[model samples]
Target chain A: MTPVGAVATIGRLCRITRVTWLSELLEPGRMVSTAIQVGSQVFLTACLWTALYAHTEVSAGLQEHQAVGYAVLAVLASRLRPLSRDMAPDSFYRHMREGTILYWFLRPLPPHRYHLVRALGDQAHGLLWVLAGYGLCTTAGVVPLPDGRWTLPAFLVSMFLGQVIVYQLSLILDLLCFWTVANSNALHVSHFVQSLLSGAFAPLWFFPGWFTTANSFLPFQSTLHIPLSIYVGRIPVNRVPREVAVQAVWCLLLWLITRTLWKRAESRVAVQGG
Target chain B: MAGGTALRRSVYRLRLSWKLTSLNVRARLEYRVEFALGILAGILWQASVMVFATVLISRFPGLGGWSSGGVLLIASIRLLSHAVYGVLFANVNRLHAIVQEGKLEAFLLRPLPVYRQVVLHQFHINTFGDLAVAVTLFSLALRRLALEWTPFKIVFLCAAVVGGALIEAAVQTALSCAALRSPTATADWTGWLDHTLSTFGNYPLAILPGAVSGLLTFVLPVAFIAYLPAAVLTGTYEGTLVPREIALASPCAGVVLFLAARRLWNWNMRRYEGIGG
Candidate 1:
């Protein structure tokens, strides 16, 4: 895309994000203050992380870089709220099954595009909170801009992909409510599993030999660990393409899974109604 | 004669509570797959502690002159305390929601003390997984250390674990009383405080700065639950005055905190406006 197009895209994204976020802002000052508090809490967590690194005799480099990486990962991990049973997509799917989707179905825009727009809007709201957290960490010196030239670009790409992957996974999990009334347990279990596999609690390197090897081939690493590693420049510049490719593959796979699930879900709804 | 009758009534109530708890476990078991999955999830949660230990140990052979075995002792104590929190006092964490939904008034109308009823209301059987993991880790650390086991040391460890549970329960109860004060604040603050304390409390107090360490030890008394007791058991501090003080005072801290918490809970009861009242 051209620079102008890229700017335009970002502007559109920002507009979507701001509008969604503003919906919750009945009192803008209170919302901003709450956001700041959230940011400060993230800063305190980063401080604790730094202290742990300094005290523990971990390798100096890992202690410094990976500690910050894990700190950011921890902040992000805490933001995931499991979809409660009441909040599950059953009602939405039921509407779709009952042909109420025809309301939107009759609209000029495709249903898939509508869903994408809605999700993007939601994600933009979430991204604002994340930025608040990032700002807090930066202010506290818990996160420093990379002295190395490659750090900025690498971190931006990795974080973007991480967000995409996480959103996709959540969407996939939410889709389960289309078939099952009791998807709460599945939601909780999937989140717990994701946290474990994604190296939110610890680096993937610390995982047991077989699990670590397996995780390397999976998209779970790309969610937090791979991006973090790239942010810290643990993986060299030459290896950037392979890392991005791995993340891209996971994204593609998730997209395919989501497409198949949506189609099957629609068919199930049709059959049940008939 | 009155005291004797009261004692008998207490015993009977305890028995009834135990039966009720067992029934809950059986009810949970009806969903056999979910029960199994919950147990597995609990184990995985426990295993994350070890994974963290592995990472720390791999990076630093020792933390502050204490070896990995010493750290394991602390971690095990923490796990046991957490198990108690999960199994017995887990409902304390839910008190905020109950208060908001006006459910507490139902219990208040009953003859039983609200606190006792609350404690006995729910049981998370998955806590057994944490208990098992903690015991296994403690034993492994003991073997690795090659410390000659004495009856005195075993007694001390048991006292420490019991005391730790009491302290954890007390803190949770104290936080629960916030539900009576500001319903929404209870959820926001208590959850944040619980997570913050539990995660940060796992590491040795020495890892933190002096002020923070003082805050954990005195302000929150989290150090009493895991660090101080583990320090005594592991003999990590040979000649420190702080260690001596902690060894003597940590268990007593639990008793004091529980008494204070009990008082606070009763005070809050009077202020409670039942649902729709």
Candidate 2:
């Protein structure tokens, strides 16, 4: 599967995992009732989106396509967990000092893979709910799919780039846990900044001139706006290659930084007591 | 003697709470770098809203007969309300964490009222950033609109703004009580609600569909925060009640909501079977 497809599949599986656990945790009756209530809430939101879009001048096809892009972005962003201060160098170092990393080390999974799986498990259900809600919105004509024939190809490429950019940026934020104790506020601020800069809360077109000019050159825009613009047919089809090329460069830069940090972190990880 | 002693004790507690809150302010100020950055972040966030409004106005010229300055008045009031909420009731927003960690139990054990303790427990000193932004925006609006500024008009405007803040805090606290009963429901919904109110509240309620306008006016009382007051202030909404009665009464909705929320909180506290206890 392509990375986007993989992320989607993984996301769905994660949702299933959490749902099964939650079902078991709650009494069967309460589980069913809660699920139904949450489901209706999602449905209502979709209906509202649909109602709003119906009155607007935006075409139906564009709405549906845009909804899909939003869905994909939401799911991926939700799944890509940033490192919490509670679980970073201090916690990790303490765990290592207590020989706790040995538990995972002895297992078949590598530490990074283990962390990734754990994040997936933790976020699966929430991501699934978002996806299901997005799907409902799309079906209900709340989300206008793009009209142009080029929307599909452009969206697909732009989404891939968006995912890579977001994942890498999050990975870098997580890496910051290696150096700082109080990064939770930093993470929260970053999320807010990203939402505004990345075009998640609304389209980048809505931003002011100076902000638009500044954000255009940043990798943050690649995370959401690039794909959104593509879906809206605002970006020409010919630009897809160049956009993806920029995303690839970002991914490589982040990867190199992450690798260097991981090496440094490992060296710093002295088993003090053990 | 007993009554006098009891009165003294209550005053002492109030003083203690004030000191604690001030200490939090002091602690936040000590981190000059983080504090400065936080202020900058606040400005940036406010700029986003202003920019959004500017774009909308530039495109449409006017929304539902309201001028840009009028809209800014609404924005300023909304930000002011948010700042008040942030400063006074930060823990109300963090109810999920309080619930999850069994922190609510500690508040229960205290001699003070649960509502007071909960409200006073966490104070986000950073909210001064929002307050600063609101003041700056309001000042700009005053200049742009060039309203006939009589002393009474200024006093009424300030009252309306402060009252709007109180109401917002009350509504937020009341909604937060839901987390006490439904732990699984996302507390982030409060943020979503705030966003929805902030986004739609800046525009004239009349521009929205009648149903939506009615819901905001009656149910959410968001109209009182900005729209109605601005209307009265600008003479767009004509009535004997505009400045004298309605503006004064509008803040009461917040007070009523807060009183009801306090009751709900008390009831929820009795129901709390401490998490992991």
Q: What TM-score would every model get versus the actual structure? A: 0.82, 0.77
In the range A62-124, model 2's lDDT, one tens digit per residue, is 353454344334333443333232312223434544555555556644555555554444345
Residue A175 deviation, candidate 1, in Å? 3.5
TM-score of 2: 0.77
Q: How would you encode candidate 2's per-residue C-alpha lDDT over B40-119 as one tens digit per residue?
A: 66666666566545544444344455677777877887787777767777668677667765777887788878777777
Give per-residue lDDT, candidate 2, residue B23: 77
The reply for model 2, stretches above 4 Å from the true place, is A1-108, A118-142, A206-210, A267-274, B1-11, B22-46, B238-248
Candidate 1 CAPRI assessment class:
acceptable
**Off by more than 4 A, model 1:** A1-63, A69-125, A177-180, A183-185, A206-209, A263-274, B1-4, B30-32, B238-243, B275-277
Residue B192 Cα positional deviation in candidate 2, in Å, after optimal superposition: 3.4
Best by lDDT: 1
Q: What is the interface RMSD of each candidate, in Å?
A: 4.8, 6.9
